[model samples]
Target: MKSGEACLHRLVDKWLAPATVLSVRVVRSGRMPAQRARFVYIEAIAPSGSRGMFFFRHQDGCWRVFPPHDARPSLCVDALAA
Candidate 1:
């Protein structure tokens, strides 16, 4: 968790000074064992006073940043394009 926090700060450093984590929420989808997937949702406030969100998935016994599309297939790629 610490490492992930550090990484998030670095990632937002260009646009925002640093990020202060506001909340961390863990969620699991599906009731069936075979369909279950765990994810961590992070809400943060940037030094510039803007809010941001980050999503990570449990894989290989560790949480890692996952693609937004993988996290939610409903999101449009065009809207998220840089």
Candidate 2:
């Protein structure tokens, strides 16, 4: 997994512990939305990128952040683009 994916996984773990992350795969990155922050978008790959966005945020001085899962979704994913 790429560094982004690794970071994403960790965030997901912290936020979705019992929920289970299965895996994280960054497909694409986008420009930093004109916000000068510690993180910025590089590109948006597609399916994986779109899926990954759901669990991303800007937290603790970092972007692509994932908070703990407060609610469960209809689906759980263990792959890049499920």
Per-model TM-score, in order, reads 0.34, 0.28
- lDDT (Cα, tens digit) per residue for candidate 2, span 36-78: 2233222223433323344334434343553323334565466
lDDT of 1 by residue, 1-82 (tens): 5554535434434333343644333333322243254543444454445454443434444433553223444777898896
The C-alpha stretches of model 1 lying farther than 4 A from their native spots are: 1-35, 67-82
Best-fitting candidate, scored by TM-score = 1
Which residue pairs clash within candidate 2? 15-68, 28-43, 28-44, 28-45, 29-43, 29-44, 57-65
Worst 10 residues of 2 by lDDT: 36-45
Q: Kindly give the number of clashing pairs for every candidate.
A: 0, 7
In model 1, what is the error at residue 78, expressed in angstroms?
42
Error of 1 at 70 (Å): 8.9
lDDT against the true structure, per candidate, is 0.42, 0.42
